[model samples]
Target: MAFLWDCYDAWQRALAAEFFGREHAGQAVVFHIDDDVAQTIREKHQLPESLAQAVKPHIDLGQRSHAFGTILARAQALESEAQPPRSLPLLAVSVLAASRMSRDAEIQAINYFTPLKRLLYGEGADDNDRKRDALDQSFGQVVELWQQLDRWLRSNKGAFGVSTITPDKFSNRARIGYPLSQALARLADRQKLTQFFSDAEITPGKTYSSAYLLRMLDAWTNHGRKRFSRRFEAALAEREPAFASLIVREAHGWDGKVLDSGGSGHLLRLRLAFNHKRARLFWVAPIATGISGGTLTSGGTEIGFESDLSPYYEGIERLPLTPASIAMPLRVHGRAAAGDPLVAKYSPQEIILFREDPHLGCWVSQDSVEAHEEHLLLVSPEQQAEVRQVLQVATSGFVAVPPPLFAAVLPNGWRLYRNVCFEDPAALSRVSRRHTETAARLRPNPIGRPKLVGGLPVLKELGSHHYLQGGAPDLLLPAAGDGSRRVSVSLGGRTPRTDFRATGYPIPLPQDMLGPGRHEISADDAVLSLTIHERVVDDGLPLGTGTFGSMAEEIDNPAITPLVVLARRNATETAFVNCDGTVWDAITPNVPQWLHRRRVLENAPLYYEIRLEPHDRGWLIERTARHVMAIPGSPTWPKEDAILSAEARTDWAKLILDVTAPPKHVLWPVYVKIARKILNDHSR
Candidate 1:
């Protein structure tokens, strides 16, 4: 994460240069002023030239008398609009001066320091090479292991090393498999690790080292190795603290089981925790395109877009495409008894897969259900027949696209009537609060509003710390006395708090200023300050531009816009941004409607979006675009059209993107800069 403190420091310097006519002198200076005394001096009818000269050292001496008077007026305006009883501006000024001095000193220190990049990345040539090779190989192995795990986990359901049968009825009820058999199976499952170790030339008695074993374990388990590794290490802590630390550091992922006391203790613990049976299985089906990007597959699979289109996704009524279950096994159809109207809704088509959750029955398969009408209706059994008939009638070479698939899973009857199950309690509560807050924010006078979707109202505790949108500051500020003269704000808007005090760096002021006081005009008066200073800076570079001016200037350069990108590698969100306002978003937004309806084919946008504040600079567009492109035929572009014509494509693409791309925000400093120019000086 880039720090915001750096940007604040830069802005402060820019303010000094533009308003005080201070050139970039070889050395930075610290000054102080007394705000109360300064105010009194400004209010005086007249001051003797000697008195004025005495005060001049603490003031922007270069400022014209008229300009000086304007400063005092602006100060008063700030005082009136401030949030509370204003402090003396002198103190603020003195603080700023000292802060700048400290920053300059730090910069001087940096000048004397040696660059550490080479030291960090370089060691003895031979050792460095070995380390690099080892790291690269380790990463490759990790990836291969992840692929293996992903494949193994795709199975609908099955026990790895256990049988369901038991001699005792109570034991059978516990679902516990014979421990010895399970143990043997687990050992067999270690073949992958064994192969890796062998390939790496590691052996238990001769060539093996603990690091090698740990590395092998990490590769085999992915990040799931943490828990068991910790347990094992904890058991060995007294004998080997160094080994324990090493294991903890190497550990990652969430899989693994340690057989303590040569296996007996492990069995006992498992039995105790799970009533003699412990089972875990994970199943995920990426849409047809896999988990590469945010796109809906013909089947029920969904991948995320690098940048999620959730705002639009959540607002849309249904998916843009329709799919149905064309073929499925276990098509056990039953008709409703004639007496009950509700039960007569449809000829129930029952299907079952490995039941992962007790309450979750088979999800509705979009490939099986056909759509003919604008709206999909769950109607009486008679209605089902009519709908099917209508669908058949319309099947005669119809050109219209099918409605997006929507699905739901009905819990098994027994689980539904007997007990409720939730996947993640924390997640459930979080999602509930966010949904409710969003719903409330959408309406006028939202007090006592009902939820937009069916779910429990989010309890206050759940959402108290949750900021659904727009909570964190878009830009960070470093201490002023960090030797940084100007804070480059990559973000677009002005910071929420323009005046901030950073550790080791005080608020900035002139070399002669001093004492507690309010600094920088409030927003209402900021415009006036800008009007007087009217300084301009290059949008693409750090260079200053023409002096104060009221004429508007058109910035047609590509550098002014902010660009955003997104990508998902291994089920994680990665985002990026560019100065030019071209934004890319790739997100595998879950289609909740499909999940809620228990449908196999998800009928909703794979991404969603919600507009928050104006713009944030840290947004990355490159990553998003790249991630989206990684999806097979994403945007479903033809392979032939996927080609980029020339190296000059940047110029062409920028033109096209400016007209066609989605708009997003820029980081704070940039926003603040642009805002200051437009609102304050009326120049673009």
Candidate 2:
């Protein structure tokens, strides 16, 4: 036990280099070995004959008066170079001594110092033969066992939560993986040790060189294994003594069952008090990616990002968004029901939900928010704006837009419904407050004046482009403080609009059905340019021998715009096609539309098509084509991208992806790095 502390003290200093601070001096591994200990190791210690002879030459036995500075110099050698310098001979000394130790120290060195010895053979091993020779002469059979564990971890990167993403071309030089996993992989390589060490005190907070980090990990692990019950109880006393004492008192009850049964995931997944320290470090990438290491700023903390098309984050709408059965848009020939008629009129609601993303934030999938259109619409349209505003706060589950705002929106007379099921009683208390506040924010209410959307009042306003999966939602909006008013619905600018004259306010407000894309409804002069987009699905795709965006006027060159795609019975969406194909998700895009044709037999691009749909994130590929290339001996066809000579033969210059993070967000360096890496590595 006493010698264990000495081992911890010795290596902790040697490995304490600040992350990436190679130029700065680091603390060296100072040995406490006196001449008597050294003399005992050289003569009486039953070490390997080679190690027995080498110990005297490497270890300073003459200096019984003081700890050896030369050994410390060897431990701290990495201050000048990369890769852990040859494992200090004293490390070998300590490890053997600990194993040969009689009482508390017998198994100690294997858990702590064994890693630095194994780290000799990682991704960068230059003089492998010599290192192996040294390892063989010292540790004997244990080296092979450690090497086997190392191999397993490297191959199973995903299982261990290592980042496979090679952002910024750093893979060729520096390896990227979770620091703890890497430390563990370089540690034993211990078999089950990875799970145990996850709770160990060592963290990568920019500290590199596994020597120091591994040593710290070893001490933490050894301490836990040796004296966890006592240490854990003591630690818990200062933090949550009540909970700890309750558990201690209750140890007579469920604790024995949990411990004896070896604990199911039910116990491990519990938050804070109930959870285990053995849980994985799942937040490393999500938080690490948000970090702007080069510079520091106040609001630089990027929680996450994703809503519409930015230069870097284009094609986000095309990402996987599986809405609930209710959230799924109404299919053309499909029969269905509604949650509420007012909500049903708005069923298949093409709501615009902007959640930059739920990836860096919480567990509630961003797609599920779209499923709540029915719930959202349950609030009157005026209140829909305010309720949504409250829902979209940074911590949607915990608190967003504040609980006061929630109370203000949904007020007393609002007949607030308790539909959401919360497991946490603490969060349960805030639900009604958020509901009430959000409802109160809805305009023309009892609390305050109206907040208008179009000519009517609203709590919040959405963007111009909206989305509708199927049925037309009824538009029954109240006029702002006027008895009766003139209302007309226009389909874009080109229209003799359908008009309903003298529509009564807050009553007899006639409803109208609007199509996909921008629909303008005006009363007096206030117009609402609202849009609803397609809820694109590859299955049950709309079929016709017609075109949406590929019409002559909608194509890139109006001169020779033939039908690029046509839908068919049992037709599957693919890049390969014959003649005209149906463009499934065609709507108002940056350009009218772009052809997404590819080689019929080969996975090659049509260059002109690439020029048009550069940022097309699978939205346009819902296209099904009939004619792909060579139109049966038509030699005059343009063979681009799929052909070797295509680049030289085409008039269109190569399209360069202009993917930069939104200019206003200066600190979004992580996302940009991720985007650039994804684009560069993959051809599509």
Candidate 3:
């Protein structure tokens, strides 16, 4: 509608003023489909730090800023001094922290960290029958909260009381003690009622200690998150929730990547629904329009330097909303079976804004509303691609700031992305997780070729950059296991066979495409020489043979033509021809690691690997030939089909086999039969 575009136009102008500091109302400051959104923009173009901080979150996420030990010590010291507990909230977190209930809990919220049973004994938790059932379970479960509290009380500074029952009852339910029954009653009353001594459960005129009764009340309602913990709270937010949630209308999002800048970002423009009913929710779920912020995962988190191992090293981190994170608009979703009411809806519940009587403030017309819901969201790098794909069809408009919060990118009706960066995030940094990937096989299924000597994994970004004198950065290899140990590597000078850089590959025209300047880098012995050009990426497409673009493994065949040869899948005229054989394993292992030995196959291409070692003027397939040449109980043409296909490929890879070799000469009849059987298969 015209009104929608008009509002968009007005929002663009507002963004121009906020982001670019443009003073004129009519100035053309619209976000063009092409304008870049950067982090920490140029000084003249960015908002002041003061201004940026002014745009705080709409929700009031609570923070617990003290360490557990400090809180515990303070609470204990106060008890030792016999002073009335001054800070109820502090005492609560300390007791909760000391309680076995919180031992395994890592969450920051007072509610979430408290044992499910201990939390149920609090006031607000008992409003429903489901909660009451939880409360009753706490009294009767295998290990009751009252039991733990009783033992803790007996241990604390020699405090003890005559009890009605013992805690350990195995599978049977334990009866409540007089001291604990009074504590439970105080908790059930919300800890506010003054006439607690007159309660039906409490003994007349006998007083209970503050440590016993007050500890159960008020302390559970305060702060979230532990303090002084240096662990990067990947929560994006470091606070816990307190109250109601608001409704959100429409949103705008922007996601960008600058490989050169080593960064990616998300930003949003949200228009919310305002009303008296929604006022309280705003205190916990705050929103501000046109804001985008995130730090580089590399420099931001504690997983430093070599990030190949850290989980958060990737972009678009999915930090789910914990009670310690930004407040959710809906009730905490429980783990329920699919289609259950307890399971949260993927998005939020839908509603309408400005459609009801007395329009609160609808900046855009006819827009429906979603009650500020952040339920289950699936986050992945693929979502970034989808955003860019949809943007390719976007109508011409200034769309600034992708929603940094993924919850804003939902439902597809009101959000748009103008661009997606094609840059590889991996290109931004050099990571060496594959340092152990020493070699590539000569082929997908190789037959006795020396694994090529690729000393180190070649970097993808090495393309398009040349290094002059002192031009290259220090090559930091994987740190040696012993720091004192050192190994030497050399970029050897041109060999006498410089005409071809890599070995085990075929001859000219289409093979060994590095052309003029070629060098083989090797480790140990030779002193280094230097020459640099941009690394090329040629994955041995339709052309080259034996070598895939670069020589990753080292193969030694002084004679190239004889080494690289063509062979047929079958002796038939229509058989597919492929190049094979070049490198011979300089030395094989003591215990041979054979590829395939005996395998039953209903089909002809039984795909077996042959390991041939040199014999007297011939080759003996050392490990696996006997099994393939002859099955244990049957002589089938198909078993021969699998092994010899590989063997024939190996033979053809070496242009022709020397028939004078004893292995072939003595087995002439077998070779001839091999030829006839294969040639007859699907014969034309």
Please report, in order, the local distance difference test score of every candidate based on alpha carbons.
Answer: 0.24, 0.27, 0.24
lDDT, candidate 2, 207-277, per-residue tens: 32333223333333332232233222232333322222222222122211111011111111111000012
TM-scores of the models, in the given order? 0.17, 0.19, 0.18
Which candidate would rank higher by lDDT, 2 or 3?
A: 2
lDDT of 2 at 11: 32
Error of 3 at 73 (Å): 16
| Model 1 lDDT per residue over 391-461, tens place | 23322332221222112222112111001122222332233343432211111110110111111111111
Candidate RMSDs in order: 34.8, 25.9, 30.1
Taking the tens digit of each residue's C-alpha lDDT, what string does model 3 give over 1-684? 334223223332334343224232222111111112212222444433211122111111122222123323333454422222222222222222222222223423332223423432343544444443432333232123234333443443322222222321111223322111121111112111211211112332333333222221111111111121111122112210100000000001111111110011111111222222322111111111112222222223321111111111222222232312222233222211122212111112222122222222312111221111111112133343433332233212324334443333233332323222212212211111221111110001111111221122222112221232222322222111111223343434333222222112221221132232333443222222222322332322111112423333566633222222222122111111121212232222221111112111123331222322221122222222111121111111223444345646443222222222123243334444454554555266
Native-referenced Cα lDDT, model 1: 0.24
**Alpha-carbon RMSD, candidate 2:** 25.9
Q: Each model's number of backbone clashes?
A: 124, 40, 21
Q: Give the 10-residue window scoring lowest on summed lDDT in candidate 2.
A: 266-275
Error of 2 at 131 (Å): 18
Per lDDT, the best of the predicted structures is 2
